[model samples]
Target: MSVCKVIVMGVSGCGKSLIGTRLAERLEVPFFDADDFHSQANVAKMASGVPLTDADRSGWLDDLAELVRVEQKGLVLACSALKRAYRDRLRAGNPSLQFVYLRGDMDTIWSRHSSREDHYFNGRTMLESQFRALQEPEPDEGAITVDVSELPDRIVERCLSALGAPDRTGES
Candidate 1:
């Protein structure tokens, strides 16, 4: 089996972590949550409802990219790679990186965010900024885009299907 690095990316509250975990499990590889790599300063800033600048994110992206590069096999990581430049930074060292964009309507995202509890992001404030910052992946970028409105299992199925995994639907 060819190892393939997969990034589950989208705006906050778009279920990147949940889906990425399932996809990684299905693929039998390690799963990473990029949010876990954020510095204490960045976390505190976001907790206070501040949007991160590119400078704030550069180090984090570099860390994620380096993690991917060092892993001999592929893995799945969940990140809110809101900007093209950030995504590029992640792809800089790991040329084989592939993205799985979790696309959803803003209303759905906001609704999900609003209901969540004990998270750093201020749903009301951050949602707008995330949308503002997001640069949708280009059609030619070779990243698979998935509509996140579907069931979680179905989303994993779609991701694996896109990755050319043999049909493991019934078993899982």
Candidate 2:
């Protein structure tokens, strides 16, 4: 079977990890959360409520791009790819990379953020910065945009359908 390389992208509170994990399981592929690949300094910066500048993220973006290149078996990655440039960087060498943008307004995401207990992205300022930085994929980009207001399973199904991949979500 052919594998699907998917990137579930959005701002911090938009459920990229949750949806990406579910989508990977349904697609029968490995899953990767880009948060795990962040540098210690980047983690510390976020933990301290400091937003990362492009310089801080350049290396991280390169690392994620490398992951897409090296993980030839195909995998789903959850990342806050908030800039068009970052997405372009990820697609630099891997043209088959598919992006699933989890789109939601600040109010919608803020509610989800407030309920999460373990995430280090606790400051509203960070959220604002992310929103300010986000560049939703354009019409010609061939990226799928899903409403974050939907249930996680539904979002996964939507992505599968859009990608022309069978939904093996086992939902009966």
Candidate 3:
């Protein structure tokens, strides 16, 4: 399989990690969580139901960009790159970067978030903020936006297809 870097990006509860992990496994590459790059203070603030300002996210975005820049081979990264500016930052140093946007309705996201347990993003308070901050990827942005209501396997299939994977015509 040809290697290519992809970022599974979307709002909170949009299954960025789940899809990114599956994509990584399918591509035989490492998976990185952008959340892991956040500073302790950022995590603490989010845990406390605080919305992060663009200034607050600058460092985190830079770190993610660096990861993309330094990866010798393609890797999958899960990040809530909600804003165009943030996405641009991630793509700045890595000209070959591609984004797979896990798009979903607000209601669907809220339902998923509500059912989850022990996540740092507590499903409430930040939903509105996330939506407010979201800037849909333009056609010119070169992102493949997929609705994430499908099963994990199907999602993975679609992502692989988006990445130009050949048709096997065997598995469901």
Candidate 4:
């Protein structure tokens, strides 16, 4: 089987983690939430309602990039990846890497964010900063854009279809 490396990306509250986890299960690969890679300092900054600077994110991105570099069987990564440069860092040595952008309207996402609990990204201001920093993938970037309005299962199906991945949901 060919390895499939995918980055499920978007601003917070866009359901990247939810869909990416299900997508990885369907694809029979490991799923990693980028939130796990953040430093305590970064988390604290975010918890304090401060947007992370590039310096704050560089090390975390490097660590994730390295994880991508060494995963022999491929894995699904859920990351905000709001900046083109951040995506470029992840794309560095992984030519087969593909990105799934979870695009959604601010109002829709804000509503979802408001209803969610126990997440570090709770501030509306940070969400706005994320939008300000987002650079939607260009036509040549080979990203698959999926609307976040869809259900998680449907979103995963759309992503699998777009990537030509088989639905391996029942294998064991």
TM-score winner: 1
TM-score of 1: 0.96
Per-residue C-alpha lDDT of model 3 across residues 60-103, encoded as one tens digit per residue: 88889999988878899999999999999999978878999999
Q: Show model 4 residue runs off by greater than 4 Å.
A: 167-172
Off by over 4 Å in 3: 166-172
CA-lDDT, candidates in order: 0.89, 0.90, 0.88, 0.92
Instruction: Evaluate model 1: give its lDDT.
Output: 0.89
- What is candidate 4's lDDT per residue for 106-147, written digit by digit as tens? 999999998998988758999989999999999999999999
Q: Give the Å error, residue 56, model 4.
A: 0.6
lDDT of 1 by residue, 103-142 (tens): 9988988888899998898757778899999998997778
TM-score of each: 0.96, 0.95, 0.94, 0.96
Pick out the ten consecutive residues of candidate 3 with the lowest summed lDDT.
163-172
Winner on TM-score between 3 and 4 is 4
lDDT of 2 by residue, 102-146 (tens): 999999999888888887775888999899999999988889999
- For candidate 4, give the lDDT of residue 164: 94
Candidate 1 runs further than 4 Å off: none
